[model samples]
Target: MAAEFDTLAEWTAQVATDLGSSFKIPAACRGSGSLAVLDWLIDELHLSHGGSLLDCGAGMGGPAAYAVRQRSVRPLLVEPERGACRAARSLFGHPVVRASALALPVGDDSFDAAWSLGVLCTVPDQLALLTELRRVVRPTGRIGLLVFVARSSEPFPHPDGNHFPTEARLLSLVEKAGLGIEDWRGTEEMAGPTPEWQSRVEKVTAELADRHRGQRAWQLAERQSQLIGQLLADSTVTGELLTLRRR
Candidate 1:
């Protein structure tokens, strides 16, 4: 029997909780797009002060390493997936632990900068994740995030899922989570994607496909590529960073 589902929210809730290697994202897209976002996030966090960084859900260490390399900041990572934690450690030997966003295994108010790079959208309790981040950062410290959103429609719930919060909704989530934002914006306006990005993606896809053999994984990758390519080609994502500061 096909697995039964009650509502889109039900599926979404599951996806938000899941952290699998084969998410609906092309590895190439996740990497390059992350690099682009980090460039801007780094600049913003640097102004406030840049050290003792914590990267929530540091999958593959690409983003952390990128931040360290470009911004000259070392990042401690927390991820729920043992696979991701191991993979990240193999690549950089940075400090990373297997943990969930809801319960961080760290002391409170210890970090100067904390960030969630494409990590917040999944966890069932957005408020819990945000609160943990807030708890770990000093009052004036900063938190950066990159999450998925939709306007009229929310994301379908798979193991690895997304949430599309309205601007007002997002602010509420942040405030309730016990933190306030500093600055936030959409990638399409300053960063996102361009037509020429495909040239880069095409090159990367060819190199990785042979290594990644699962059919479902490959198809999901293709689908996400199309969606992001479209998002890059033209800004279509409903969610945009609504910059905030903790009160």
Candidate 2:
């Protein structure tokens, strides 16, 4: 029988299953940005006990789980991939909804705050995603984002399914979406993973090698990660963290 996998979301789900109780370690390192980045956003969003948060495009429920763990907040995860949704439920026991960011299933003013990490580049309709966020979050609610902005107009190799926006274009989209910028920061270099984070990732990698070293799905996911790393390293893309308020 063929190995049951195709997308990076599947690979991430497998990793989450293998990690089991320690899933949050690698979970903290992936998708949501580093620990430092998460801290900044969580603090700026003012997440506290009993508060509600909506994680847009939450893959495998890593960052959302981390937020719940750190702040005791209630979290709802919105992910498009089925495998990821399943993994997120198993890994963190949080409510996972399989849906697109452009059209969330929840009602208006549903969440206290909303955030998307490393997800803006993947969606072509950036304005639509932001507008959806603005609608779901209450008026004056905060919306945090970690986006990879294009460094130049010159054509550059980017991972498949990505539509990175220039900094000016991203800002314009936020304004059109009815959100006002509250805080902005440029992360010139991605922060290095903490020691625990590195160790946890290595553990997952070792298990993957042991289980499916040469599988096509694994290779494809690895290639995608490498391509993204190269883009960040060569200054082809720059990371931008923004905190916006629903207007």
Candidate 3:
């Protein structure tokens, strides 16, 4: 039988099944445009067999594993969280490095391409993260990123205390880190508020609360959903997908 889903939806649904409801990808990341994003990443990075791809943050290993299987690319996943690293290693069977994005353990020019999804916002030092990525990836190597960017300087309340940088600030950081932005897409253009997303969020939250007994994971899930919903509702912060090349 054909795969049930070709995008984040299937992967996240499965994650929710395995780790209760708290581990699912946010509704904001599951949309019709997700397949297009995957296609763009493959095409822009020119992924192929034997080429090394670095998955920064590498959350749950779903998207990275999907990309590797789809393109036959070798991947080295770097995740700071031990739980996430374990999950990635077990699920993808890919080599995983438990390290921070600011300090990648890989040697210089180790990867042909690198990408991160919904991770940049969690990083406090964008330049450090991007610099590490640039150092690890070969010169002129392609980089693709999808980040939640702020529309203003005011910090957005988040469970992770992540920095939601303004578009200009984020672009500046990328350029400063010696990467050139080749193209960009905004949230509305990528995955705006999808119909039924609210219901999905409610269901996930309720399920997580039940399973985790409203513990840390459940609370985090609820807060994350609230943040995403607010971002979508106010249009204050938007998801930005960028195609970049290391310089």
Candidate 4:
């Protein structure tokens, strides 16, 4: 198992600790998707107050926490990283399970809705991940995904641990996993982040640099961020937001 120290998880955990009691922690930890995207998905999922939600591959639990604050829904977070799980629990006081997306520890049909953001490309077994998500969600439940789909056949640089699928391939995999597409849209050109959101993120970034400058964990995380930014800038991959229903 990977140690908690000198990893992106450690950096994020430290950021949460440094930003203690500040409302910016959640905003700072929200991965690729912007606030607009989250709001749209939440509205589309039709999450009711007090309903159950499962956040698979939920790193640091920022989005899950945001959902809780917005809709008062009960969230069970499943994250694979140990340090991130700890951060989520300590920072947001949410129940988090350190587990893999391929085989969730939850019971069958345990959630009203589920979602995975910026996670599909990172997992090599995309089909199994989707299948597991389907198993845990009710037959009437919805599953939302924010994926980076390949836009062209030409080879382009991408961050390590990423295996982006073409749109057609992604659709086929969804069908294979017994999921029906309710709606899909492109988010590559979604509105920019709000000033407040940007500000929160900047503060966290500045703090991380000041605290862990030249550290191995910080260097690794910075490289990963740069690679992801390059992929987005080159137009080699496009963001796709899909709302799926169990068939």
Candidate 5:
């Protein structure tokens, strides 16, 4: 097990290697999709040079790497997962700090902006995280966030059954933190789940279920992926991207 404070250099190497760039895409990662997650942030955030940033829940340094590549940005990343923190530091020079979203270690007015992608819903204390986010930003600094809030059609809550605040409610939570939402868009994939992945998952799951030990392992991996695919299938489950300026 990796400690929270450990530098993201030694824990996991696989996720780090996956964070590489394709020269064809101008020294950017192109594997995850046609567009990089970092590119996505840069486009939406539109940050300028000398923009100090805090990236909460930066996974394997994808967005962090993007930030550095874009404008020589040094994003301070916060991650509780040791493997992820290791990946962030190893893949990108961004400093990886072992910190919980609810209680950041940085001082007030320490950052020009804060971003946390794909991490809000599973957080146990949404309000706490928002408050902490508000604390770090200089007055008028913005928070660019990509969060997956639950909708009625979703199933299989967090493995730990954490709260999944709805998108509408999530904005209110941010407002409570003293930042007003400046952008809102809900992406819905009109089509349902793809047959190919669903079929493959069902077959693999049943096969593994025949064995007690294998069933548990397979269920965790296969079931979770299936659930994620289902919810995100039509973008019925969507991300709320907010550029909120701190008040």
Candidate 6:
């Protein structure tokens, strides 16, 4: 995945420039697309210096590394994927525990706060994931989540066969999980899909197709990005950030 590495390298450089920090980001841990929103979510957590945070679906550990270095928050990354778990340790020496979000391996009240980036929508059992998040974090711990939700009843195709919950369904799940809503808002006002986002998706799609014509991961990422772009363009899907506190 030369293209993936190249894109990540470029983005990391830009982030370094914008933030004025020379913290090196590993390419293997960088997720696709603009990660500008990551900073906002980190800020939402209001983590104190040297506090611990749980990173649900911690992919590649790039974000975890950045969190530790920049935010000064000790992060425990939990990722189920074997490759990603290894990459996190190998690339950044970030502490990683291999586990599913539905059932975190850590003990109860283990972290000061927790956050998940772009992972909640893909889970088939959102309530279970929410419950687990509540379980692992301490009472009154803040949780920051970024997800894409259905703007209408229209079905959106996803590679993982997961459906986006409506606003009401999400609220119900939050209540069921015993999480108090600290804040909820649409991300469009803060960061909507721009031409640059579309261009980057297209570039990544083409690169994936050229590199691996028949690979499932390549095909899935390409198709998912296309559908998301379409849904975003038509306003059928909305990106959201939710802040919750364990009760």
- Candidate 2 per-residue lDDT over residues 67-186, each given as its tens digit: 888999999999887777776776778998999999999999999999999888989898999999999998867999999899887788888888999988997999899888999877
- Which candidate achieves the best TM-score against the true structure? 4
lDDT accuracy of residue 206 in candidate 1? 52
Single out the weakest 10-residue window by summed lDDT for candidate 4.
1-10
Candidate 4 Cα lDDT to native: 0.81
lDDT of 3 by residue, 1-247 (tens): 0111112223344455665433343322332235456667777788888888998877556666667767988888887766666555545578888788889888998899998887787778888988888888888688888888777887556545567888899879998998988888774664433445445655654554565543554455456557676875697777778888865
Which prediction has more favorable TM-score, 1 or 6? 6
Please give the CA lDDT of all the candidate structures: 0.59, 0.80, 0.68, 0.81, 0.59, 0.69
Q: Candidate 5 on 105-196: residue-level lDDT in tens?
A: 99989988788776676577888888888889888777777667677634554433346677667868987878887765443322322454
> Which residue pairs collide in model 6, if any?
none
Model 5: lDDT equals 0.59
Model 2 misses residue 72 by how many Å? 0.7
- For each candidate in turn, the TM-score is 0.74, 0.92, 0.79, 0.93, 0.72, 0.78
- List pairs with backbone clashes in candidate 4: none
Which tens-of-lDDT digit does each residue in 116-139 have in candidate 4? 998899899999999999999999
Q: After superposition, how far is residue 15 of candidate 5 from its true place, in Å?
A: 6.4
lDDT of 6: 0.69
